[model samples]
Target: MIKIEDITFVAAEAYKRSGLVLSTDKGYLLESRLAPLARAEGYPSIEALIAAARRESNDRLLWAITEALATHETFFFRDNTPFDLFKQEILPVLSRARGNMSTIRIWCAACSSGQEPYSLAMILEEEKARLGGLRFEIVATDMAPRVLEKAKAGVYSQFEVQRGLAIQRLVTHFDQSGDQWRIKPNLRSMVTFQKQNLLENFSGMGTFDVIFCRNVLIYFDADTKKRILQRLAAQTASDGYLIMGAAETVVGLSQDFAPVEGRRGLYGRSGAAKSAAA
Candidate 1:
């Protein structure tokens, strides 16, 4: 059994590094997730691993702990509504507003294992003729190096592809290699994946016409959520949209964005923002 003190340390360290809250009740997760890592690192137990990590101040091990605790629960087009809204509502609006000459910039924050961005890429491909020659740039970012590597490879197992990926899309956008499916080179090229931490400054990453930060903020505390929402707002174009997970919202947490009428999880620059700009 993992000790309370060790659980506290792990929780605190994870929050410090990733802004992920790990309450004491989640001690079981620490044990289950970190056991393999502990054994791999030559520690007899999670306690010893945490002890050594603390004593040696091992940044690598600490980061491994954070990564292990991170919820990488995602699949291609995980939620159908968001993608439908993007393809049906968001794209038409963007195409009309920006015209064919301008490119649409999309940032998929915390995109896990490449599914989310790839889903968007597939939509763009399907709608290419409809878009009137408008170009698109997709930048996908995640905090974990391990997932980013998998995302860059553009490969997924049979089971992975089965989740949320239609057989038709699979046939069109992927080439079967043994038991794995590899995303077509053209589709893979549509997204640029990079390592990014939401806790850090986003000034270098310029504004985006659409930001998909879905299902990410629920892991953080209130302050952290507010901070991330504010940063996201700053990176959003004045008329751009912010799409979050169904469970997350800008209400009470931030005044930088307001919900797009009748659209769940879709937000635009708030009235307060407009007044401030005016």
Candidate 2:
């Protein structure tokens, strides 16, 4: 077992670098993650791994540590309700408002393993006739490069596919190879995956009409969540929608956004300075 005090400084430094909060209560989780890395590296224990990490300024160890801490357990259409709302309400509004733009842009902020964006692609494909002259782009991002690579591959096992995908959509968009289903080339082309850290300024990425930042903020404390939500607000378009996980809400965290009633996980930016009585 590693002494909490010995690794506390390094843990704090790691948290500062990644914006992932760590506390003594989560020590056991760290131990379980580090144990495999320690054995693979021939280190005797978690303490030895920490000492090795501190020996030099090289970031390989730090990368491994951060990767271990990242949450990567996401699947296609993880929750069905939000997707239902998007198909029924959001897409129609965006398609109409886009007019001659010919392209619809969406961002999946913490797209782990690629299921979420791919699910969006299937939805877009289903409505292709309605969007005859329109193009669509889905930008999927995450802090973990390893998972991004997997997402880029667009392959899922039978168990993963059965989780939330409908049998009809599966037949239309995927090809079966043994027990795995591989998303077709056309569907894969609609999504672009990249590495991004949501905690930092994202001004360079440009604004989006819809941002799906689901189930990601639970890891951050209140202050961090507020900061992240503010940054997200700045990057979202005025009429755009922000969809959070069912359990997450922007209430008390932000006043810039207003909840859309009857919609469980939807929010829209409050119009900016509703023009003074001209």
Candidate 1's displacement at residue 216, Å, is 0.7
Q: Best lDDT goes to which candidate?
A: 1
Give the least accurate 10-residue stretch of model 1, judged by summed lDDT: 269-278
Per model, state how many residue pairs clash. Answer: 0, 0
- In terms of lDDT, the poorest run of 10 residues in model 2 is 269-278
Work out how many backbone clashes candidate 1 has: 0
Candidate 1's error at 21, in angstroms?
0.6
Model 2 TM: 0.91
Q: In candidate 1, what are the lDDT values of residues 34-111, reduced to their tens digit?
A: 999899999998898999989998999999999989999899998898899898888888888799779999999999
Overall lDDT per candidate, in order of appearance: 0.91, 0.83
Displacement of residue 208 (Cα, Å) in model 1 is 0.3
